[model samples]
Target: MSLIYEARSSSSLLVAGVARGLTTQGGRLVRPAENCWHMVVVRQGGEASMRLVGPWTGAGVASYGEGAEILWIRFRLGTFMPGQPVTGLRDQETLLPAATGHSVWLNDAAWPLPGIDDVDAFVERLRRAGVLTHDPLVQDLLHEPGSGLAPRTERHRLLRATGLPLRHIRQVERAQQAAALLGQGVPIPETMFRLGYFDQPHLTRALRRWVGHTPGQLLRAGEEHLPLRTRPLDAPSLH
Candidate 1:
């Protein structure tokens, strides 16, 4: 199986990236822990579907047929569709009704799906239509890490913008970081130390829950040294 991925450039502050990919010989795709939401469009043969994926706190699996073309806009941690709170969609996938000309319904209005090259333009259109908006405090808290906002106030702002607690976000980030380190051939014990895990078992539990792999399995797969920088969390276990 082969897959090609590209990160599209975007100017919208709410969008993290517009990622486009094509999978030939598709099978199962494992989505690891993450804090952001994804607006995904998948096309197989002549049929296409659009959906919104909310923050995933644990590992999950998805399957696609061969020759599937997928395009997704991954929103930044603290952004969501206006009038649709992400908290309601946490750990869930909500399908959007398809409209004419490859468009989809968002808030009962038709939203045209732009080509990979037109992501910035599409975002601009959403902004003009008042369908995309974000809380300014999220940017402030993210960029100004040292902001002295009161703890209670900061927590409220974070919940409003990201639909998740700070602790959950940290857990997801740490789990992803651990996966990257393992893919680089780091030993589990060392990775645990580096990431401040309590012990090997602690690391193992986090990986199993968030990355869907045990350390030993990840290490064995790393021996093949695949070109893909990111390891597939769905990789089979050695045990």
Candidate 2:
């Protein structure tokens, strides 16, 4: 859980971040549900592999190696590479073909992986090369709270941008919010009411699907001081 460096993209259209870290001990860690896709590069024993982690609907466990160097780039919700559509990657992990230690083949070209400090520049290159793009309507819909478009139009736009239905997005968002509140020691009844769940069962279903943990499990983990990596990439602060 030790992070060596972390940074976010400077571009407004690309709400993403990069983190590099090393694990002190090797074991399974809970990777909570996330809205964005992750491009991870790991190096161990003089070997490296690049993998793409799609938006996950449920929490999962991932294994890391002790003292391994891990670097990852998490893309924004509505942003994606042209050839690699977000829809195809949903709830799956795909290994990217590598051209070199610091480069991968993307969009029929060799894309040199940028270091933490050069993420913005790399995004700029993607923009110029037509590799990175997002729907303006999707951006507006996510940031504006509400949109005036017709229901059908809004659904279509969201699907085109995020490759998932609005209901799915709301479920993940609510589940994450609930997990955050629970981690903060909020009472279960209060959390249910505040999150607009119909009842305890309703809340439990959402948490089980999106959070991969029940309310009691989350609470116990918090009380027992278990390490859970549920922090959203867009959080203003990093640890």
Q: lDDT by residue for model 1 over 130-195, one digit each (tens)?
A: 777777777677657645879899988788678888777878889889888888899888999999
Among residues 3 or more apart in sequence or in different chains, the pairs in candidate 2 whose N, CA or C atoms overlap within 3 Å are none
Residue pairs that clash (backbone atoms under 3 angstroms), model 1: none
Candidate 2 lDDT score at position 217: 84
- Which structure among the candidates has the greatest TM-score? 1
RMSD of 1: 6.1
Model 2 C-alpha lDDT per residue in residues 1-239, reported as the tens digit of each score = 43333444455366477776656567776667787887777776776777778787677877776667677788777887777778777789888788887688877898876655676777788888998887777767766766898878988777766778877777899998998888788989999999999999999988877777888887767533344233444554432
RMSD of each: 6.1, 4.3
Off by over 4 Å in 1: 139-152, 223-239
What's the lDDT for all of these models? 0.76, 0.74
In candidate 1, position 173 carries an lDDT of 83
